[model samples]
Target: MTSIIQTQELSYEAAIKMCVAVTQHAHQLGVSVGVVVVTPAGVELASVRMNNAPLHALSIARKKAYTAASFKIPSFNWQERLKHKPDTMSALLREENFTYLGGGIPIIVEGKLFGSIGVSGATEAQDIECAEHAITEQLNSL
Candidate 1:
């Protein structure tokens, strides 16, 4: 029935692997960071905070994951998308767990959205790199 929808469930194992991989990458880069993996519904599955990662990073990372999963778009891209739509941007910023940060990305599996990853505490470039590398080397291999 059209009213019933089937959804792919994200595995907790994959989420934990993602958290570890992201943390490893951040360490290799000499950047302490917070990493999180979440389902498309924005429920967190795994989370990590590398040594010395800022206390605030955990909250920011979770929000970044939520934003990407909820919107199915990289969180950083929101900056440009709402650039000309100030009213919308303002409204969005008012919401909790939403950010236009570069560390957030959507995870695609077999041409379908799986979930999302978000990293924080380092430069935006470094955060993005760690997330991408973990997803590519860890999740994509699954």
Candidate 2:
């Protein structure tokens, strides 16, 4: 049997707003960063790399966002959960667009996973802070 499922997604405008907010927060922290927002299906809706951010940050940020959206959990959680399972971690790491980093966060509203945001370029803590700030602000505005 085939059945269709409908899911709510983050709008393009919202994704842009989130990316902008993350960029602003990164700037306020005196860091250049790359930010990405992805839909529930792991499709990137918006992304930005601040001037002087690391050249590799943009790709990492997108992968982080995709990981969070596809797995429905913060990217760091995967690292923590998989650390003790070497075999599982090795297998998961082989998956495309899967990153176990702190900067990726799933954006949930009213218990629904709408999408995700990822930030990179600075320390993992700083990147996570920027992503968290943007997601919180967006959720609060809802």
Candidate 3:
């Protein structure tokens, strides 16, 4: 029997660090965003909404994280597919809690997917940039 080393899921510390980095990045960019960090099963680990952020941004960010963690694909890809394939998109849209938008990113550790992080409230591009920077700057440090 080949014994495999066990890798743990995301820690509260990691989630907090990622959240701080994400929120700071958004502030530096002048974007008031809502961010969500979720486990692989779509459970939220941490969430934050900046002051003056849109009310819908919290739900949007959560959906983005759920979509990425459940589908194992970037949320923007679903958005693109939805634009080109309405029927398929409709089916996917019907899938419980999936979203088609930017700002969702999977967190990979030791070649395994741990969970996802998502940001919303700015332009799609800016949302994505904030999420990416969070992972690159904070998650990597963990």
Candidate 4:
């Protein structure tokens, strides 16, 4: 029999900090957005939606976070990675929690993945910028 193992997961405080950072960045850009952070197991730790952000953004942000944590890759990369693989692309698209758009980013530290952050409710570029800013701010705080 094999024994089960565990690894470091994202802390609630860290997840909230990430969401705040992304929200601040979006505010600075004069954009309303939604942000979500998830653990390595794809469990949501924290989430926020700006006052004017679309209601749909809440679910989208969560999906992005889940996808990033589940795959350990930037959500945007999936689009390019699957561009030439129609079958794979179609299959992935069929997933209820999968998103190939930008704004999802994995949080890796010391070669270990802690979780992921996702932003939505703005242009893809804007969403990506917010996600990146959150990561940079989180790293700096550490």
Candidate achieving the largest TM-score: 4
Query: For each candidate, what is the lDDT?
Result: 0.90, 0.92, 0.87, 0.92
* Residues 42-127, model 2: lDDT tens digits: 88899999999999999999988999888888998987799799999899889879989889999988789999998999999999
lDDT of 4 by residue, 1-142 (tens): 6598879987999899998999999999999999999999888899999999999988998888888988999999998999999999999989998999999999999888999998999999999999999988988888
Runs off by more than 4 Å, candidate 3 = 1-7
**Pairs in steric clash, model 3:** none
Full ranking by TM-score: 4, 2, 1, 3
Off by over 4 Å in 2: none
Q: Write the per-residue lDDT of candidate 1 for residues 11-121, one digit (tens) a residue.
A: 889889888988888888999999999998898999998879999988999999999998888899999999999999999999998999889999987778789999999
Query: Where does candidate 4 clash, by residue pair?
Result: none
Error of 1 at 50 (Å): 1.3
- Rate residue 130 of model 2 by lDDT: 97
- What is candidate 4's CA lDDT for residue 125? 95
RMSD over all Cα atoms, model 4 = 1.2
- Clash pairs, candidate 2, are none
Compared to the true structure, candidate 4 yields what TM-score?
0.96
When summed lDDT is taken over every stretch of 10 residues in candidate 1, the lowest stretch is 1-10
lDDT of residue 23 for candidate 1: 88
